[model samples]
Target chain A: MKRLGYLLGKDMRLLKRTPTIVILLALYPALVAVLVGLAVGRPPTKPRVAIVNQVPENKRDIRIGGKKFDLDKLTKALYENVDGYNVKDPAAALEEVKSGDAVAAVIIPEDIVEQLESSSSQGTIEAIFDSTDPTRKAYVENTIKGLLVDTNNELTNRFTDVSLDYINIIVNGGEITFGGETRNIEGLANGADLIKDVLPYVPAQQRKDLQEFAALSEGAKQGANFAKSLLRRVGQPIKLQNKPVGTNSSLSSLAVAVAVAVSAMFVALLLGAGMLAYEQEDQMLTRLLRGLAPRSTIVIEKTLLAGICALIVGTVMVLAFGAFVDIRWERAFLWWPAIIVASISFGAAGVMVGAASGDVRAASLASFMIGLPLTAAALVPKGAVSDGLYSVLQVINSIFPFKPSLDFLRAGLSPGFDALWPGIHLAILILAYCLIASFAIKRRVA
Target chain B: MPVLEGRDLVKRYDERAALDHVSFVVEAGESVAIAGPNGAGKTTLLSMLAGVTTPDSGSVELPGGKLGWVPQKAAVYQKLTVRENLELFARLEKVDDVFGSATRMMDRIELAHRASDRAEDLSGGMRQRLSIGMGLIADPAVLLLDEPSAALDPLQRERLWELLGSLADSGIGIVFSTHSAGEVEGHADRVIILDGGKLLYDGAPADIGPGAHFELAFINFLRARRAHVNVGGDAE
Candidate 1:
């Protein structure tokens, strides 16, 4: 144990003397965290969309169910919803999208109003998007679709209001003109009732026919009232409301920050591997091995040194992310242990790599190659990959420290995070990696 | 009593033997020089004796099991000051009086004035001295160095030899590997020559050949060894 302290002290002095390494160890992870925070924390930028209106000015204003509607109103709503600019024709709008000047093009057909007026036809508004960039294309498509849905709801509401007014005229007994003679609907119903009252003096057969006529008059009035009520609800029947439970909306950003911070283990791995390789290059390992210091003590000291360096980097990254995003500073206690264990795990893995590699350059390249892909695989969402690939990633995440460390950090930062599995997972990984590193070091010395 | 002994040390890398059935012994208060061409197993032999490496089929006997090793290059921590390097090694070697041992080693290596200077700031000779001091801090019975003065100038080499000679005179057996015949002739009390994983000669440097020039004797010995190997191969 005393020897281990001496070795660690020597490494610390070495690290203190090398200013560039110390700076890189702290800055690399912090930069990654800051960049990721800015990406997910900031509001999304609006996509540029081209609007092509093919309708003539004269036919722009059309009547639907005796209510005047303007096609310009729909286009105006679209313009308000997106970063829109007018184009002369569909070809020009498509050209804008294809040339990358616009993310999408919305083409309003010349006969859109005619299609809306005709009950048998529906209007077709063409949308063109640059398919090469699927993510931007999907965003633009959804934005335009949302705008169209709102406009469709408004048009449906206006038509329903007009239809309801006509139903009201029938149900409330309004006056109507037939063959140049004006007659009240209530007066006709009363005349039928008068006939029914006279039925008691007539024969039984005549009474039956009068009863049927009275029934028909009441049924027509009741049906019109029901139709008016149903038409009023036709505009919108379902409303969606979101009720978030337990977790804050900003917690996702914190989770992202944690993931980015945990990735700093790569830096730790490089430091650990590079330190060992440097010892070998400088012939310090040979000297230490020749002394009374045991091989295991050397390995442990190097692993701890790497872990300590990584822990500093991880802490800095978290703080850097806190500058850009909402971080739960109160929950830092929960993540500190996780970061420490994870850094040690990566450090041990780095030692193993350094032991197996031939030199400093080989060790550095190996650390990057192993750390990058494993880190990415551990953090990639299940939905981002195929089921087979995701299953493979799940195995990797289960065994490696990256995903577990990220989960542990996220749990620390958010509310209602349960399950103590990640802690155990990281513990097991640290032990396994440390043992492997020791074995590799022993083999190298042999 | 012998401070270090090796019996039939044989180390093979696949089909090539780095050291084949080599054997040697170093007595106390003796300075022995191991002279060899490149790939002649000097480092391999030294490593085995220091316990840094294991031979395929040999046993190294050190009475106290305390040995010191200095690699071909000066292996001091460049970032650490001379005193710090000494103290660190002393602590690692489990010396009871760490501070006192370091101070004594600094003075013994004639680097006491530069105790606070980082090893990297020191000249090649000073760094080598520090490295040797680190090896000596444990008070080992035998010290093994692989070309300790390989990077030193004439003055530095002379100073290094003087320090090593004094250490040997103080009853610590010193064994060092070198390619310089001058070092073997002037500094070594005994010499061992190796070529092609075989021990060519082991005796006093003056008694190796009839000639006065040790370099000519060494070249001629190598030629004779090659001729003997060729004749043996023809016989096989």
Candidate 2:
């Protein structure tokens, strides 16, 4: 054990003296974590859109039942939600987008009002956006589509009100006979106010019927108001309430997992190939063997160094994630086990490679060849792939240490998260991998 | 008993014999130099004797005590300071008070002034000295070196011999393999010549005569041995 300490200390001193490689290795994962953290699930900035209104100038005046309406005024009201710069010609609007003056161009259809009035068919609004800023272009396109949606909603509401008004006019203009007394139903909307005043003068049966009628009228009026209000809000139903379990978003958690996995791999490989394999490459191990130290001592020292390096890199990645991403560390207990398990597992793997290959370059190359695919399997969004591919990926993911670690992190970082059973199972899985690797390494060294 | 001995040692690589039935013995306080041309099994024999690798069909007996091996290539960790390297080796050898031992070893190797310098920053002579110091850290009864002064200048080689002489006087057995017989002729008490994985000569260096170039002597010895083998094959 004392000899092992000396070996580890020697390696540490060597690493300290070679500050360039040490610093580079330390910063690699941290920088990657920050970059990935900042990028995940963040919405694109709003884009500037150039608008071209093509409805004829003379057709701007819209008349309905002798009431004059300005089409431009209505369009302008809906366009207020968009960051639109009005241009004279649709071609000119597209030219502005091409010139990088705007991210997108939206041209209102030429016969929009005519289509709406004649056939009730909505006219399409043509939009063009720069491909260079795809995210911003998509944002602008969605915004414009939303504006058109609002215009259609407003038109529908106006038609509904007009229909209601006509119904009200006809009902008021006619009369209904109740108990041989003809009463106008147009005032039914205010019947509750009228009934209280007339209750004393009416007979019991008549009074009861009037009270029922008044209640029915009041309910209908309320129901109509409710329908109108509901229609106004109908476009945006099912509001998404973002309830994050931890400080990190789902994307941020994924980023953390990937960063941790890669960093753990780097640390392990570096220790295995760079520090442990150096002895063999330089024939120092043979010397040590001839000396008092046994092969088991070499194994112990290599494992210890790899483990320490893995822990350092993993911790740096996690801390960088926490700093760049707003991850709630209060529930960190849930996720920390994955990091620990992954670090040890990778470290053990590194030692195995280092011991077996006895060449630093070979060990490093093998580590990367194995690690890259494992990381991808662990971190790639399972939903993005086909069901069949995802199933296959799940199987592949199960084969590597990264998958269980990533799974534990994802579940642990989710909202309303409980039941650490899955995490425990995954921890055991990683532990099994680490144990197997350690045994292999020990055997190889011996 | 001799401090170290090997009997009928055989080593093969890919069906080709590196060392064939090679045998030697070294007593305490003696220095033996294995002289050979390229591919003459000098390193393979040393490796087997050092117990770094096993021979195919024979045995090597090391002293019932510590042993040290220095490969042809200097194997000190370049990133570590001279003292740090010594300290690590000392600890591995279970030396108590590793720091004190390391400092003493550094002073003994005449590298005390550069104890803090990284091994890579040292000159060839200094690096070789440190390598030897690492080998001495185990306090081994016998030490094996493969071309220890291969990369050193003449002055450095002389200094190394002087150091080895003092160590020999202190009762340590040393076995070294070198391509240059000229360098080992006066320093080594016994000189063993090998050719084609077989020992051609084993005797004191003075037996070759005072004025003979050791290289020419070695070459002549190999040619005569090969001729004798060829003549015996024809008689058979």
Candidate 3:
């Protein structure tokens, strides 16, 4: 044990004496932290939308329910909430969208106030989108839809002929009114239940009008509820709530995790494969083997040195990520096992490559050939690769150690995360890598 | 007592034998030189003696202590300082005092002044001396060197011989291979000549017949061995 410790210390000393390797070990993780900070640090910029309001400047009022609502104020308010530029010419607005200066254009018809004032129909607003980028277009369209919907709802609530407090009563499961009679319907939970409670109290003459209005109102309420649900689904397909248990947000957590994994892999490969090959090149390996130290000692000491380097790189990456960006350290302790396992597994892989090649140049090429895909497997975001390719990568990744390490990291960062199963699985994978590496070292190099 | 012994060693590569039925012994304080042509299997013999590789069919006996091997290439860590390199080997050898061993080697090689210099920065002769110093750190019972002076200048080779003589005098068996018979003429206590992986002669350096240089003697030896092999084949 003491001999191994001294040998490991010597390896570390040799590494420290190597300037290029030392610089790479320190710089790679620092660069990763900065890159991650740059990539996902700030909130995404708002998309530009061109708004062409055709309502006359002189006539800015829409009369409804014996009250006049300011049309100009509503339009100004909507534009303020978005990166909306006002353009007079509709052609110019469309041209801006075509030129990529704006993602979409909102064209309000010239008689918007007249239409809003008309109790017969709702106003129509047309939105034209640039189809160059479908994802950007979808985001822009949803934003515009939301803004317009809110405007329409505000107008409906303010100046409608009927203030649907009565209709809202049924929707909200509060009270119902019909035939100048009101009844509390708090106990009822559904539309049908409310209708059943109210239908019996209506007089014969008012029955026909009340029944028709009730049925129409109930249907409108149901349609509105369905639309609200649909709008939510359209706005965001998945709602992942990053519970603030440790870091301020999930982006920071993901960035840190990826940085650690990437840096750990490189450090491992550099120390494991690079060092092994270096020993061979120096012809010092045979001399070392000719001594009292066993071949297993050499393998173990090299691996331990690489593992130490990996731990240093991993810790630095995580710390730098946390320092440069907002990350939760409350559960930072939970992530250590994953970080340590990642270092060891990746280091063992490097040892395997080095031992197998038995040449530094060959080991270097092999390390890169192996490290690149494995690092990608752990750190590449899902959508970054094509759907088909990503699925294949996922399958390939699952068969390796990095994926389990990443899984363990992700589970640690997640909210309400109380499971230790992934961590145990990762530990097992790391153990397997170590065992295989030891066996290979003993058989091939020993 | 014999510090090292190998008997009837036969190492074959495919159908060709690298070393065939070669037998030799080294006593506690003997300086043995293996003299041969380039492909005469001196290195193969040295490898077996050093226990670096196993012979196909031979028993090599060594009463265990540090058995040092200095390969033809000066294989020290180029990045590490001379002192650090020695310390590393000392640690590997499980030497109780790594610093003491390193210091002793540095002083003995007359490289104590450049102890802090990286091995890569050292000159060829100094690097070779460092390699030898690393071998001596463990105080080996027998040191096997494969063409140790092959890369050295005449002055460096002379200095290396003087060092090897001192090591042998201090009771460490020194077995080294050389291409030049002149290198072993006066320095070596015993000479073993090999031709075609077979031992042609083993005796004191002065007993190789009269008025003949080592190269000519080696040619004559190969001719006699080949004629003997042909005669045996015809008889068979």
Candidate 4:
């Protein structure tokens, strides 16, 4: 124990002398935290899309229920609804998309107004999107699709409203103007009543014909009433209400903090391995072994020193992330235990690697090769991988420190934190790694 | 009584024997030099005596059970000051008064003036002295060094030999390996020469070959051993 203290003191003095290493130890995690915080805290940038309007300017208006609706209004809505720019033709818009200046292009046909005016035809809007990058393509596609749906809904509602107005005028006996002539729709319905009243005085064949005409007129009015109700339903069939579950807005920041803390663990591992391997490569291990100190003392000292350095880095990273993002600083009591245990666990594993490798360069390389894959596996979501692969990852997470440490940190950030299981997991890992390190050191010195 | 003894130490690597049934003893206040050609098992012998390597079929006996080892290279921490390095080693050796012993060691190694300087900033000779001082911090009954002066200049080598002479005079046993025949004859009170894992000579330098120069005598001894092997005679 006394020798361990001495070894630790020597390491501290050496660390003080190497300013570059000390600075890097603190700076690396802090930088990672700040960058990740900014990335998650800020809103995403909108993707640019090109709009091609091919409709003729002279015939851009269509009359609906005596109200002039301009086709240019649709184009203006598209521009206001999306981050879009105007292009002259479909080819030019496509070229913009292909050149990476825009993510997608929307083309409105030249005869769109004519199609809207005709009851038998519908307007078609063509959309072209870049598909080289799948994620960007999905985003652009969703944005354009949403705009098209909104436009379709607006057109449907206007058509429904106008149709309902004409139906009311015809069904309830009113006058309407059409093609420079005013006609009383009530007079046409009153003719059926006149026919019915005169049916008894006419000849037998003529009276039968009059009775059929009067029934047909009454059926038309009832049909008009049914169509008006159907049109109202067609305008809006389903309504959606959005309600999010959690009130915590700092979830992204918490995730960034966890990621930065995990990175700090890796830094601790590399530092511990490199420092121990350097002792051997520099021939200091031989001299150290010649002293009365036990081999376990050296391993423990290295593990503790590495852990302390990494803890400092992790603390700095958490604080830096908090500056950029809202973090639950009150949960630091819970976070400290997790960070301390995880740092020491990884540090002990690093010392084991160093002892087995017995060379500084080899130890550092091995640390990265082993740590990166394990950390990646641990961090991968269960839904992202197949069942078999996720099962294997679960086993790795149970044995390694990365997953448990991440979980501990996430729990600390959460509203309700339970420290029992994660604490036990980290304790087991630390013990196992320290034992392995001790064995390796003894074998190396033997 | 002998301060250290090795009884027929034999160490092998796969098909080659690094140390073949080697045996020796060091008395207190004695300075012994192990002289040999390349791959002659000098380091293997010193390593076994220092307890750094275990012989496959032999035992090393040090009644006091305290040994100090200085490896081929200067093994002191380069980032630490000379005084810091000495004090650290003293503490690691579990000395009661770490600072006092470290100060004494600095003066003994003649590095007290540069005690505050980092080992990396020191001259090669100063670093070597610091290495030796680390070895002496424990005040062991026997000290073993492997090629301690291999990289030193002539003047540095002379000063190292002077330090070793004084240590021996202070009643500590020292065993060091070297390739220089002059070091074997001039500095060592006794010499042990090995070749091809076999001991060629073990006696006073003057007694190896009467009236022959020590270096020539050493060469002729090796030639005679090869000739005996060529004639299919026993080499033991």
Which one is best on DockQ?
1
With a 3 Å backbone cut-off (N, CA, C), the pairs that clash in candidate 4 are none
Off-target runs (Cα >4 Å) in candidate 3 are A37-41, A48-82, A86-251, A323-333, A359-361, A378-395, A415-446, B10-21, B35-44, B55-57, B63-65, B178-212, B219-236
Clashing pairs in 2: A247-A327, A247-A328, A248-A327
Which order, best to worst by DockQ?
Answer: 1, 4, 2, 3
lDDT-based ranking, best first?
Answer: 4, 1, 3, 2
Instruction: Flag clash pairs in model 1.
Output: none
**Mind giving the per-residue lDDT tens digits that candidate 3 earns over B1-236?**
68888899988888877788999888888988998766677888987776655688988888645578888889888888999889888877778898988999898888999999999999888999999898888888988888889899999888888888888888999888987767788678888877668887888877765547755665566566767763121100
RMSD of 2: 9.3
**lDDT for B141 (candidate 4):** 85
- Those runs of model 4 whose alpha carbons end farther than 4 Å from true positions after fitting are A48-81, A84-111, A115-149, A152-250, A416-418, B8-22, B35-41, B53-58, B193-201, B205-236
DockQ of each: 0.55, 0.39, 0.39, 0.47
The DockQ-based CAPRI class assigned to model 1 is medium
Local distance difference test, each candidate: 0.80, 0.73, 0.75, 0.81
Where's the lowest-lDDT run of ten residues in candidate 3 chain A?
A: A159-168
Please give the clash total of every predicted structure, in order: 0, 3, 2, 0
Model 3 over residues A1-446: C-alpha lDDT tens digits? 87788778777778777788799888888888788877777776767889898877878787664457788777765676678889997998989888989888899888988887676987888888876787886887788877776576556456432344433454666655554586776421365556667888978788787777767766776875665455445534577986655434366776677777777877886678878777767767667655456666767677777888898888777777666676667766777767877777777778767877777889989888887877677667789989998988887787566767666676555554543766676566556655665565444422
Off by over 4 Å in 2: A40-44, A54-96, A99-101, A109-111, A115-124, A131-249, A323-330, A355-370, A381-399, A415-446, B8-16, B55-57, B193-201, B205-212, B224-236
The 10-residue segment with the lowest total lDDT in model 4 chain B: B227-236
